[model samples]
Target: MIGIVYITAGSMENASEIARELVVRRLAACVNMFPTFSIYRWEEKVEEQNEIVLLVKTDSSRLDEIIGTVKHLHTYSLPAIEFWEVKGEEEYLDWVHVNSS
Candidate 1:
């Protein structure tokens, strides 16, 4: 199975660092990062801030490792890390599995 992990980082540099680590460790086949504005409740207060979103593509089997890595590298005490099982083109899915494995 293939999966896409959605995570948010404090900045582009942080996002890049996490992305590089994931790729180097073969936990992710590819990572796409972009700037985003986020609003959420924290500590009983609503907050708004700018953030970088990281989209990680990988084999679903690697999700546990990916989560651990992200937790270790992420700056936030509680980072937003979510994922969903996804279906893409066959060749792409194969490529992701090979690279991540």
Candidate 2:
């Protein structure tokens, strides 16, 4: 099974750092980062902010390790980490499975 993990970082630097580490550790096959605007309720107040979003590709089996690494390296008290099962081209999914292992 392939998983697409979504993580929001405070800045581009943080996003890049996380992406690099994940790839280096073979926990993620690829990570795409982009600027995004996020709006959500926190502490009973609605807040909006600019953030960097990371789209991470990996095998579902690696999800736990990926989440742990992100939590360890993340600066936020509560970072956004979410994932969902994904279906992609066979070759690509196979590549992800191989690399993520």
What's each prediction's clash count?
Answer: 0, 0
Q: Across residues 14-87, which tens digit of lDDT does each residue of candidate 2 receive?
A: 99999999999999999999999999999999999999999999998998999899999998889999998998
Give the whole-model CA lDDT for all candidates, comma-separated.
0.94, 0.94
Error of 1 at 75 (Å): 0.5
Runs with alpha carbons beyond 4 Å of true place in candidate 1: none
Query: Across residues 22-79, which tens digit of lDDT does each residue of candidate 1 receive?
Result: 9999999999999999999999999999999999999889889999999999999998
Clashing pairs in 1: none
Give, for candidate 1, the lowest lDDT window spanning 10 residues.
79-88
